[model samples]
Target: MKLGISSASVTERYGYDKGFELIKKSGFDAVDVGLEQYGVESDPFKLYHRSEDEFCTFFDTIRKLAEKWELEISQTHGRCNTYSMDKEHNAYVRWVSERDLKATSLLGAPACVIHAIVSGRFPEHYQNLEFMISKNAEMYGDLAPFAEKNNVKIAIETSGRAMVNGREIKGCFSDAPVFQKMFEAVDTRCKTVCVDTGHTNEAVPFGAPKVQELIRLLGKEITILHLHDNNGTYDQHLPPIRPSRGTVEWCEVFETLDEIGYSGVYNFELNLIQFGGVMDEAVRFLGKYLRYFIENKGKLM
Candidate 1:
């Protein structure tokens, strides 16, 4: 249960080298290479523009930098455009995902988290969900071999409701039962789940399962995490500590992780806005607080 964080926010502010330095200075043991899949993108990530060799070389360099600091390249987020409505862009997303698998392998990371498409092609949420699931099965089933060949398992992250067309919509893979269905639908060991704590919390208002119950349902199926906090409605991505940080059922999360023997990284995906501008020191403080409870086996919780 090592402390880790996504490099997206830090890298956006500091670039890769300095961002890696800040991460090391923040007392983290591992990191998730954000392939710039987060946020709305008008175009693909700059890394995706590089030639194949350059992409591989870039990740290799990033991996070496992590090694230089004694930090592990634990996982990566694949480039996925969850908000884009253009079906054509889906083709590019799939292409970049394969490249990401290769880069993830080069980085020595075991998994890559790719988001399912939010196909808002239908009026009802259920209809859109079914379409997304089919698309996921098709896409993942096609890429399963590549994932295995690259030694990078693709993690299907739990989805959250986000604003689209001025209305909130719950997308596919929004809950544990949907996860089970997707697994049944796609027969591949190359795929797994990366449960986002904030997303699951965000679903509570719509009668989704509690975080602990979802943990119990998913159990060992979970191989990674996108740990963060939200206000149980909006996707705030706040630090997972107190001060009404909406890390709901915090004790149950750790307790259930122990029960399931989860050894994966406790990775944070903070948006870096709610900390009152402490910046790097704030990241360090949040990591320290999380480790305190984890190391104490929730006795301190």
Candidate 2:
């Protein structure tokens, strides 16, 4: 597996250039850019708002950084779930999708990852959910030709929430059935899935085997893998820990990847909230963990 790290880990301190440099220095082969999370006021709980010029400048900076570091721009991520169920929010989602896809294409990234839908009220509001899916497809469809022209795929991330009885069912949306349905409805070579291990830990109960099964079910449609570990409670975005019952096995994960013939980047997706000021130290820890895995992956395979 080619190793990578997400830009979200160092968005506060390094910005784009230093973040890319740190990723490269840490022995990562690629970097996943969290486009909407950083450099914009597009937090999930906040209003979706950002200037086009700002995003353009962000894209330009990333492109230059990628060139300078000889790093592959693995994917671009957007915050689609931040939008509320309104016409204006829907328009904003469309605009962000188009802009992110264009930027991904320009940067020669293979895929762009975004949430499938907002978590809390989706199950209670079936009509709105259906409308959102259809609208998302239509909006994404508008970019199909452009995606074809630019050679970038749009990937819907598996979410970590479930809706039941007008409330979240803790962990539900990231299940294989849900992902299968999303892929079926949004079927296209340019549209795919990005399996986030942390989200999967929150949503699915079957551990690493389940993750492998989902990848198998998704088949070649699985384009990217977000390689963060969780402790089966919250999305702890921590480094890979020892696996337990109903938890993912890092070694087994690498084995499964080899068995499935996965050649994409295995991106580390940690959050700095828990790591605190020891971001570099945390990265080094993760780097050592990854190096151990890489050196031992052949045995596992």
Candidate 3:
């Protein structure tokens, strides 16, 4: 597994070019393009309003820059909010997602990550786990053909539990059984799961099927990951390493990956707060983390 990082980690502080430069200098082999927010002057991160011509021009430039820096587009992430009551916002999110599918395809990325819209407070459709599964199936079913046509897969990510609007809301894809149901419900060859470690830690805390069990349940269907560490309480998105930093079981994770024969890029989804926006610090952390991963991978087997 090759090491990769997300552009979202630095794009908020640095422009696209400078961020790509930092990622290259940080020793990463690939980058997950952040389509999460809009940066000034049509950044790839915020690509909601760009016309086809504009998008093509931007993509071409980024492609050239990636080639120059010797980096590959590992995957792309799009924003979605299925729980929102606002029709306009929901429509906008869907529109951007459609555009993101094409944008990811244009970059020649094999897959794009799509978030599961979980419930906020007051129990919306998310109150019914079955409804949530069916909702995701209906939504992704509509996008599967588009994904196949673009030759890009959609990776449905697992989410963390959260308290919103004075109510407790469980994550939609938290449990392995529920996750399997949602994945199976989609019934599309173009869609797969993107397991988020931090979220998994939140879901199965002191439970029957831990992270490794969750992986075992989703074996072969997981094609990507949003690897990160958390305090076992929230989705902190911290760098994966020592136990003091977070509670992720790195050794067990690696062993399970080996068991599943996972050969996809090992990508980290760290938030900038952990490294204080210092590129050198980020590089150092990744170097140590990758060394640990490499030394201990498949040891249990």
lDDT of 3 by residue, 9-96 (tens): 6756776687777777777888888766642344644555657788878777877777888889989887645435566755666666
Instruction: Count the clashes in each prediction.
Output: 0, 1, 0
Which residue pairs does candidate 3 place in steric collision?
none
Best by lDDT: 1
Cα miss at 104, model 2 (Å)?
A: 1.6
Q: Give the lDDT of residue 236 in candidate 1.
A: 87
lDDT by residue (tens digit), candidate 1, 1-301: 6888887777767777887888887778989988754223444557667677877787788888888888888899985553244567656666767777888889899999887655343335445556667766877787789998887898878877755556775554566788678766776778888888888888777777777778888889898989887888888887756666575677788888888878889888888755545677777776687688568754553
Stretch of 10 with least lDDT, candidate 1: 36-45
**lDDT at position 103, candidate 1:** 80
Q: Which candidate would rank higher by lDDT, 1 or 2?
A: 1
> Model 2 off-target regions past 4 Å?
38-58, 80-84, 118-121, 126-139, 142-146, 163-166, 170-172, 206-209, 243-246, 297-301
Note the residue pairs that clash in candidate 1: none
Alpha-carbon deviation at 55 in model 2, angstroms: 5.2
lDDT of 1: 0.75
